[model samples]
Target: MGRKHLEEITLLRGLAIIGVVAIHSHPPPLSLGFLGLNKLYIEELSKFSVPLFIFISGLVLTFRYTGETIVYTDFLKRRFEKILIPYLAWSGIYLLYRYLYKSETFSLFAIAKKFLIGSAYFHLYYVFLILQFYLLFPLFLRLIQRFKNRKTALLSIAAALNLIFIAFYESTLLIPERLPRRIFIFWIFYFILGAVIGGDLKNNKRSAADKISYKLLIPLFAASLIYLLAPAGLPLGSKLDVFWLMKKTFFYAALFILLSYKLASESNFPTHNIALKPITSLGKYSLGIYLAHLIILEPLSTIILNRNLLFILTLSIAWFFTKTVSNLPYGHLLVGKINNSDT
Candidate 1:
């Protein structure tokens, strides 16, 4: 049997990529307090993009390959071909850009170090972090299967471990000097949650919209907003400060995943609605857009000062670039997989 394609997942990808661009395109500080607040809101809200992507990775991987006997070598080979190649390609491009425009000098040692650690660019660290998950996926899969009957307990343990790790890191600052935030421990909970959801969906074949209530969405949104903004006013060392911004980000990531599944359950979501074509297209070409956006944004930022306009331009240009490349030979290596089906 073929894998079922979920339009909602694609929609979530589209939304997440937009959020990613928004994070990178947030306006520079201005003298106005309102503008500062807007910047803070954008930055805070968009922080969920990376986590959402991570969640989607776990969900899709587990949903597709749960029962199958995966060969570790084959899996790693596929991932390296699809993801790592593009990462290297883009990392080299960014490095060259820095050398030419920013006048950054690098020795052979430095270049190798940058590639090893994903320090070639600010955003590329995510690729490094995700690669670690891919490497450890077999162990994670084994553990998940072993504890399949106790999923709730497993998830609770994962969540607790994540929070404990965050608290320890916050207190000791013991993150690896080379990798920094690229560590997998900081992100395991989202991946585990996604894997559990994927398993549930696969085994039950139920609509997520039916499982998750719509009424809870508004409350989640309100709570997320309040949590995000509250820290700005609350004094340091408050409860909110315990996890810092991570608490709110975790809340928002889960809420966004629920929202995506709910919307995807709609009958006319992407297929029947013409207005959603652009967004679905964004989802289709998300990897390419993601890899190429910062390249486009760097130059565009100088010319276009408006944050909203800059985001639009970066997204539009990156989408077009990805679309054009996806039609060429071996383009998938550069952009990850492209869903060629019409929206």
Candidate 2:
């Protein structure tokens, strides 16, 4: 039910990880120029990165664990141990970094509240989002197993539910802006659709329709690019919103992954081709870099480093730091995986 090792997925992960970093690598205050364009394009490419990550997680988890009898408690325990420990460690690290380096102060109780909500820093919300998905993995598995035959309907329902939530949440029913973000309703569609894709793969049911979807992707991608390139000064009355972009992002990621699968099959390129080795390695350590790269950015922001050069340096340092730390004793507690042994 699992995908045999595929090099293209790793390459996609490498792209996604760099996209993530690029979103954060804004240039220093100056006039708009090539550096500004760099930031804009990188941000556009990265808009789908988080959703892609979530989709990948759903796809891989469903592919690997669909038929296994899930002991919910034990499964959650094992999964959370790998993820929550690193989340908590990094949360605390960021909290201290804020207090010591920025000369900010907060009460212990305040910090605890911030930690619970993943509000200790900007990027930590993804941790909570992923953790919530893990907490509900058992339900997800059951849904996928039972509804694999009706995947289109299942995915359609999820999309409808998400859109309904967006419609209401964006209007004045007073659900409170922050509540929806912390809940899973906003993202269920992507995750469920990912499971559908994975389940189909597990069932060995590739069809010509898959190729049709790939062909359909080119126009969809162009439309998305046009939307991004459009002027941004419109008022809130404009119908285009983040949710619209999100819907497009879902399909963009979906079609891209399908195309990648098709291409991966066609290419006879060695998985460890010299050009791909570093990217695959970076993908392997994406988690640690995602957690720690903000620290690297703080100093870089103050200095006059070229944004492109800074990005490369940060990627290298983050990968090196993660690799070295993950080899040390108790490293798994801090970084989610051990590097000294075969994982």
Candidate 3:
């Protein structure tokens, strides 16, 4: 199936990028007033950004490859040239930042090893996650080909795997250091969901239930909120409360589906609306912005002297900066794709 311009995905990506900024940017110091609630709400909203991005990656890949004959070597080659190149470039950028600006010292060999593991920067774990998915892609496609008609069953199995992994993570069974918490198994469901959705779209056999709506989401959101309303100070970890991850994974997937359904609709969505265009552009450049934002945030924190103002200013800078970088030669090697020539 040939790909169309899915602005809705870009819109979601744009939203997710901002949500990430919100997560990293310091919120206004919580107050005794409703400001406290506001902060918590922002945190809850931002929790889904990482998962949504992973989901989109799975969706795009599955959408592209489901029915077509896939060349495994070609796929990996494309992934390496397109994704790994930029990943390494940005990784080196962050390592240099740490060494020079932050005054952290480490051997070149150690830095190389850290890059492999995605410890170069706090946010680079995402690249590691995607690499995991890429490594597993051919296998995923083989399974899909074998179980060509068993999408729901495959999805169910993947969901079960995710839950079981969570249970193990939360159990007394020691999670090995090599298999870190951010491993692909922990978020397998999203990738599987994407494959199922993508294949379904290709087959043109979409399920009505999968077409989420506001009616389905509102009650689900309420239940999720209640389930996740733990005390603010509760120690959170995979071991402590796997339900936190469970709730976030389910709720955000549902919410994203609902939002995508809406934005993907015909009449109400002004795809070219002037006001919304910047956000869509931001979404297009999200990868670069994701990589480069930390560099700016570091300096901005000290000079700005105000958290809220600093957050907005840094995002504005990062957005334009990322856009500029993406336009230069070899930019796609850095930021994935430019999305459009106009972009």
- Local distance difference test, each candidate: 0.76, 0.68, 0.69
| Candidate 2 weakest ten by summed lDDT | 236-245
Best by TM-score: 1
Q: How many backbone clashes does candidate 2 have?
A: 0
Better of 1 and 3 by TM-score: 1
lDDT of 2: 0.68
Task: Provide the lDDT at 143 for model 3.
Answer: 78
Off by over 4 Å in 2: 1-7, 27-38, 168-179, 207-211, 231-270, 338-343
Error of 1 at 67 (Å): 1.2
TM-score quality measure for candidate 3: 0.85
Model 2 over residues 1-343: C-alpha lDDT tens digits? 4445444556556666787787777532233366655555555556666666676677666666666677888878877887788989999999889989998889989999878988787678778888898889888888887876677778779878877776666564456545666677787876786677666655566622253555576776676666664533334334333233344444555555555545554465454788777876777777888888888887776784677777888888888998888899988777767311011
- Residues 5-92 of candidate 3 have per-residue lDDT tens digits of 4456677677778877887775433352556555555565566677777767776777677767778888889777766787898889
Error of 2 at 186 (Å): 1.3
Angstrom error of the Cα, residue 173, model 2: value is 11
What range of 10 consecutive residues in model 3 has the weakest lDDT sum?
235-244
Model 3 lDDT on a 0 to 1 scale: 0.69
Number of the top-ranking candidate, with lDDT as the measure: 1
Clashes of each: 0, 0, 0
